[model samples]
Target: MATSVAKCFLLSRCSGIIRSVTLQGKLPPVCIRNRNLLSQCPSFSYGNRASDNPQDGHVNIPVDRLTVSYSRSSGPGGQHVNKVSTKAEVRFHVYTADWIPEDVRQKIILYNKNRINKAGELLVTSEQSRSQQRNMGDCIQKISDIIAKATEKPHEPSAEDIALRASRLEKRNKERLKQKKLHSAVKQTRRVYFD
Candidate 1:
């Protein structure tokens, strides 16, 4: 069973031709990259983060905190896309959401300045999938991805790391100066001396 799952994962990841793979009526956990196909497999689970800690690296907005509305999707699905309200639009007050960490809220505000409105609400939308449930999930995932990106911090350079970078920079400067001196000598030789 594990091998089958691994094979399915590898096939979907490696081959762009194979968007989804169904094995024995069960879909592997390869729906993350292509979230539009998430509706076809109800059993497949993406990262359903529930914790509030930003340091933990995942943030899941409580259902109550989110205000979701559905509209007709303009994506591929032919007649179904035109008739059904599959597009999901989610909005939440970033400043009022107590579940998110204060620091993370600040970061979200900083990173997503365009997404946030004057009322301090973060708006997210998804029309990638034809299914309403899948589209809603996609909207949530988009928000989570944004929050996760904001949560990441650049690693502080250690003493050795800093010293090594300084030495490499010094070496590059010396090489540049040597090249400059050689070029100046060549230009001097080209000049007609008026001795």
Candidate 2:
């Protein structure tokens, strides 16, 4: 029975028809079909993982190292918004994360001091999703993306690059002096006391 069910799922997914998917549950298969179709009809998928962090394990956020919680959102959705906790706050302690390098950790701290609390944790949030689970996923993905960027090493300018910059600066100074002389000549032309 399990094998048959798996086969059914595989066929349905290949054909891009979610209607045939069903588990041995009380919910009607038609209801599930409708729900699946509705979910797939959306333009965006919350499950899309784009993080480059190696420790994320292909899920963007390594859920084991992250904490995500929910709170009620204000405005719109009437009672549901005020009553249910749909806002998700994702937090990670950069100071204690074993996977992060010391330099990278300090960079994150210095760059994200506003988001980091006194305990030196990086916090990201998402209240845009109507569902709490989706919001949490989005927040986790965002934090993961940020940390991934931070994990990469910074590039340094070479001696040749520095000399090129100095040459550019010298040219710029010459241009500025020429511009100033021209400006002074124009100003002198407008002077009535010029002999």
Candidate 3:
């Protein structure tokens, strides 16, 4: 029975069919259609191991290290907005999160100094949606974007790039010198001999 269920899941995933699958009693029924949506479910089977693949350039935040909370959102949701908490705020300590790469953690801290509190937890909030689940997804996406941007390395100038820059600088200096000489010549003509 277990093998047959596993085969069914693999078939659905390959065929791009959205099916709600629950594993044992651990994970909730999650829509398993694509790899993109897999990250949204914190309890997904590959959620923790997804970050191990460095080739994808994505750093998946594990649920164990995250702190998520919801609060009442101030927006135009009529009576529903006042009664329910839809604003999602996701936070994780930058220094203490062992799942994040050490160098990337420092970069996240440097890039988001304003967002990180004194306790070193980076906070991201989203109140765009009336549904708490949507708001939480948005918050997670924002954090993922910040981490992705932080992971980018500075561009190293190649020999061709350096040569092109040098040529441009030389041309600019020559033009400036020519302009200065022209101005000096104009001022020289403006002078009159006292004799």
The candidate that wins on TM-score is: 3
The candidate, 1 or 2, that scores higher on TM-score is: 1
- What is candidate 3's CA lDDT for residue 60? 45
Q: What is the lDDT of candidate 1?
A: 0.61
Tell me the whole-model lDDT of each prediction, alpha carbons only.
0.61, 0.55, 0.62
**What are the per-residue Cα lDDT tens digits for candidate 1 across 52-136?**
4556554444444566677777857888977888777888899987767788789889989999999999999988767665565
Report how far off residue 106 is in candidate 2 (Å). 1.2
- What does candidate 3's lDDT look like per residue over 1-195, in tens digits? 222222333333324342222111122222233444334444311222244553345454555566777788996989999998778777889999776678878889888999999998999998987876556556655776676677678999999999999999999999999999999999999999998
Off by over 4 Å in 3: 1-60
Descending-lDDT candidate ranking: 3, 1, 2
Q: What is the lDDT of residue 73 in candidate 2?
A: 78
Taking the tens digit of each residue's C-alpha lDDT, what string does model 2 give over 1-195?
222222222233323533221221111111112334333332211122434344432222223455556678766898789788778676778888766656667877877889998887788987886775456445545664565556556689999999999999999999999999999999999989736
Candidate 3: residue 133 lDDT (0-100): 56
Pick by lDDT: 2 or 3, better one: 3
Query: What 10-residue stretch in candidate 3 is worst by lDDT?
Result: 21-30
List clashing residue pairs in candidate 1: none
- Give all TM-scores, in the order shown: 0.67, 0.58, 0.71
User: Model 1 — TM-score against the truth?
Assistant: 0.67
